[model samples]
Target chain A: MAKLTMTVNGRTLSADAEGRTLLSDFLRGGLGLTGTHVGCDTSQCGACVVHVDGQAVKSCSMLAHEAAGSTITTIEGMANADGSLSTLQQAFQDHHGLQCGFCTPGMVMSAAALLAENPKPTEAEVRHHLEGNICRCTGYHNIVKAVLAASGQDVSGVGIAAE
Target chain B: MYAFDFVKPGTLAEASEALSHDGALPLAGGQTLIAAMKQRLNAPEKLVSLTGIPELKGVCAGDGGVTIGAATTHAAVAAQAAAYYPALAALAGQIGDPAVRNRGTIGGSLANNDPAACYPSAVLASGATIVTNTREIAADDFFQGMFTTALHDGEIITSVKFPVPQKAAYAKFQQPASRFALTGVFVAKFADGVRVAVTGASESGVFRWTEAEAALTANFSAAALDGLSVPADGMIGDLHGTPEYRAHLVKVMTKRAVVAAG
Candidate 1:
């Protein structure tokens, strides 16, 4: 087993992971960070998206040991101090960005990464950036609305009514 | 996936030695390797990750071309190669996705030699050099066939050197499901002549469309390729498309690439 050391959600965590341990499995099972969901277990779905060193990456496609010494941010870390929802999270809630919410963590993480890089993403840019992220519910209308709204874009006629 | 041991060697020598052992596979980015392992497609006894070696992760421009470190992420190439090789950067930017591009490396893509991969077309069209730890292999002699390369056991790709062309562009017709190329064409024009490489359509992997190249070399324009067409005899055929369809696409994509290059 390799001793994987990394800072996750602003906290340094250590875990003993095997060579076959995926970063998604390591985060959920080893460190108990269940916020990073594994919807597909395959790399195609972005449900396992997380920020490694400020860049969005699919955790399922990365080995835990390879991510040693890096700073990781999950959906859990994407909140303001005192555990309140950040602007992005609030935008999701206000925009009805989720229905079952199974894909919320990954969606939120991916959106945060997108806004970080391109803070003023357009509707097409937001949709293109989220090509890897898949949502089974809500038809992704509100999800796109949430991301665009979070980017401070006016989403008045963005998608079907958020209701 | 079968259980395996993992190692992250800090240098090329150590990584090579680690991979020299039986059932040890070098992992770069693990975008494809990890996914394959999970599917029980490739279960090695050990994984030697190349990410730990700092020297294998960067980009530099000189010698009339661009040199990209093997482990440099596609995101890095997209951001770094923009000013030097805009077409290459554009291709890199559209690979897989924002997240996949963040983890997938140019070396890993080239080494795996995925038929639908974008880098092979770019590298071949640009006449790049694949630099391994021991020797530099020309792009023409590097790719062998589907999921195959000239790289031998324990050999590691250190970087790829891409010669900048006077004009270049890549046009990819991608499958919606996998986002891989249905038929991608890269057209590159150099001082000597023009090179046209087509990927995702050939059964033999990425190969130059020599007929298209000759026509474009004589006159670098989409009009030059009016009568030129790829033969469907050896093209890949699957549910995505038939061999004839892929062959037709090769010609179409080449023309689109030429127009874009202009």
Candidate 2:
């Protein structure tokens, strides 16, 4: 066991964990931050994506012990200081991008990472970047629309616009 | 995953010392290792993480090529090696996905030597040098078979020195589900000759297509491969694809790679 220290969602925190504990388990099971979901724990389904040191990574694919001393941000951190949804989260609502909504956390995290690197990604680029994330509800086109809308692009020409 | 002792060493010596112990596995990226552990398929007594060692991460361009540190993630290679070797960098860019690329390392990919991996094709086709703590091994001598390599248990790859080709490109037919190479081809055209390496198709792991090399060396064009085809018996036949299907992809991807290289 180890006492690992990391800054999560702007708060410096410590968690007692074993070497076998995954970052997802550390967040959900240990820290009780259940926003970081784990759909397919094998890393295929990107439901557990989170920002590690400002770069997105699959939480399940990493060990909490490996992430010690780094800064992290889960879905719980994607809100404004006033506790309202961020632009990306709002876009997901406007576009009706989610069906069951299980994949929303990872999709939001991945979109944030993409915009951080390529702020003005094309529609095709948005779809390509979201390939890691799987939403079985066929909520893809709307999700792509949401990502583009979140980037402040004129997304009216793509996907179903809000009524 | 089973309970295990995890140690992230700050130096290569410490990592090597930790790995020398019984049932001690050196974890580079933990992208593949961690997933395997979740299924209880891999239960190591201890894991010595090599990523924290500064000496094992970065891309240094020299000798008319690029040397990528073992612990350097695919994301780093895609960003750093772009100016030096665009073809290799492009290959690194499309591997897995945004999250997986951020965690998976070149050294871990080459060391694991998965039959469907992308790095082995690039390394074998570029004729890169796999540098470890003890010695440097040629790419030809490094990869043994699927999930096998020439490295000793305690040995860890420090970096890979790739001799950048004048014209080189990789074309992968991705397994839609995993995004891994279903049967990828990497073609490199040097001043003297051409080298072709195929991955994801062969059951014996990555192997060079000498016939394709000879033909492409004579004429560095896609037309030169018009009549080439590999035997299906040696290809991997899984639920994703049949042996015959993989064999066909090898030829098709090779041609596409040659054209892309041109």
Candidate 3:
């Protein structure tokens, strides 16, 4: 076992984890931060997306030991300080970005990362950025709407559900 | 994943020393290695993490070309390599997805040498050099076959140096599910001649389209590739696509790349 420390959300957490412990497993099992869902055991599914050292990555594809000393942000940490929904989360609700919601955490995390980098992405850019995040529900139309709305773009004619 | 001992080496020498041990593998980004481990495809006794080595994590552009550290992530290369090597940057940007791009490194991609990987086409077309702790191998000499390289055991790659070409562009037809190239073509035009590397199509792995290169070297235009066709015998045939389909994509993507470069 390797002893590792890292900043999760805003809190510094340290734990003794096995070398085979995945970041997703570490988050879900070790710390009980189940917000970072692991939908696909294979790295192809983006349900395990999280931010490590400010860059979005698939948590399932990285080991806990590899993420040592890094800062990570999962879906659980995206809420407002006052414990309310963040703008992106609120937008997802307003736009019906999810149905079953298994992929929402990863979707929101991936979109948040995109908006952080490119605040004004086009419709095509938003879709392209979501290539890794697969929604089995096939609710991509609304998800795109939610991301565009979060970016403060005009999503009126972009097939967003009426508020 | 199998039980393995993990060691984060602070320097390249230390990492190399660790790799000299039996059943030791250098871990970069952990994008491919970790996935393979989980699937029971690979099980090494020791994983020497290269992320801690500052010497192997950056991009440097100079007179001849761009030198990218082996540990430099794809996202870093995509964002930083635009000025010196736009084609390289564009290709890097299109690899996998945002999440995969964030952690996947150039060295890992080249070392893995997946038939559909984007980096090999860039390296081959640009005539890059794979620099290792021991010696520098030309791109032509570096890649041997499918998932194979000339890298000796315990010889870790330090960086890759790509000589800037006058005009170059890469175009890929993604396989939707994995986002890997169904067939990708990279075209680089230098003062002397043209180089075209086709990936995701060849059975033997990434190979230069000599016919297309000669055709474009004489006349650097999409129209120059007019009746040229690649045989399907040496191409990959799988559930994703037939060998003939991949061969056809090679020509289509090459034309698209040349047109984009023009």
Candidate 4:
């Protein structure tokens, strides 16, 4: 076992996990942050996506011990301190970006990270950026629209309903 | 994943010592090793992660060439193109996705030496040098076979030295599901010679297309590769494509890459 100390969702978290414990397993099993799903144990699926040191990564592919000193952010960290939805979260709801919500958390986190880096991305850029995050629902049409909407644009013509 | 002992060595010496141990695996990005472990394919007893060794991560430009630290992420290499190596920068940008690029290290990818990997083609075409702790291996001799490399136990790749090319291009037909190249070709022209490498085709791993290289050496033109036929005997055959299909793709991609390089 190894001792891990890091900040998660702005809280300084600490734990002792086995070397084989994946970051996703540690977050979901130990800290009870089950919002990060595990669609495929392989790195192919982005359902376990999270921010490590402010960069998006697949937590399943990383060991919890490797993330000892990193600052991690998950879907639970996106809301305001008062529990209100974030701008991106609201845009998802407004544009119907989600269907079954299985891939929502990962999609939202990836989109949030993209907008944080490049606030304004073209439709093609958005599609390319979100390629890792697979959504079986909504076919990603509205998700792309939600990202554009959060960037302060109306993407209704891009097959998404405008708020 | 099977239970394993993990150690983060702070120095290359310490990491090397750990790697020298029996059944020890050096972990770079964990993009491939960890996934294989989770699937119960490889269960190493000890995992020595090299992330703590800062010396293994950076891009240095000198003497008309660029030496990239083995641990350098694809995103870092891709983002630093205009100031360093432009052709390499472009190749790194097209690997996997942003998340994979951020975590996947160049050394890890090359060390894994997946037949369909993108970097092997680029490195081979550019005639890069693989710098190991013990010795340097030329690109032509580095990759031995699928998921196999020339790296001996206790020998860790420190960096890859690439000679700056006059012109280079990588063209690949990516497997839509995995984003790995179903057929990829990298063409590069240097001061003295033109090298062309084809990856994601042969079961024997990356191999130089002598016909394409000879043609390009004589005349670096798309028309140069028009009549050459890559042999289908040793190419990989799988669900994505057949050996003959991959052979055809090697020529098509080579022509496109030559045109792109020009």
C-alpha TM-score for every candidate: 0.98, 0.98, 0.98, 0.97
Query: Residue by residue across B139-242, what tens digits does model 1's lDDT show?
Result: 99999999999999889999999999999999999998778999999999999999989999998999999999999999999999999777899899999999
Candidate 1 docks with a DockQ of: 0.88
Candidate 3 — which residues are off by over 4 angstroms?
A160-163
lDDT of 4: 0.89
Weakest lDDT window of 10 consecutive positions for candidate 3 chain B: B149-158
State how far residue A57 of model 1 sits from its true place (Å): 0.8
Higher-ranked by lDDT: 2 or 4? 2
In model 2, pairs of residues that clash are none
Candidate 1 colliding pairs: none
Lowest lDDT 10-residue stretch of candidate 2 chain A: A154-163
Say which candidate scores most in lDDT: 2
Candidate 4 chain A: worst-modelled 10 consecutive residues by lDDT: A154-163
Steric clashes per prediction: 0, 0, 0, 0
Model 3: how far is A46 from its true place, Å?
1.0
Candidate 2 residue spans exceeding 4 A from truth:
A160-163
In Å, residue B191's CA in model 4 sits off its true spot by 1.7
For model 3, how does the per-residue alpha-carbon lDDT over B151-257 read when each residue is reduced to its tens digit?
98777889999999999999999998888999999999999999999999998889999999999999999999988999899899999999999999999999999
**Candidate 3: Cα lDDT at A42:** 86
Candidate 4 residue lDDT tens string, B1-262:
8999999998999999999989999999988889899889999999999878899999989999999999999988998654767778888988888888889999999999999999999899989999988899999889889988989976899999999889889999999988889999998898788998888999988888988888899999999878889878988999889999999999999999988887
Question: Listing every candidate in turn, what is its Cα RMSD in Å to the true structure after a full C-alpha superposition?
Answer: 1.1, 1.1, 1.2, 1.3
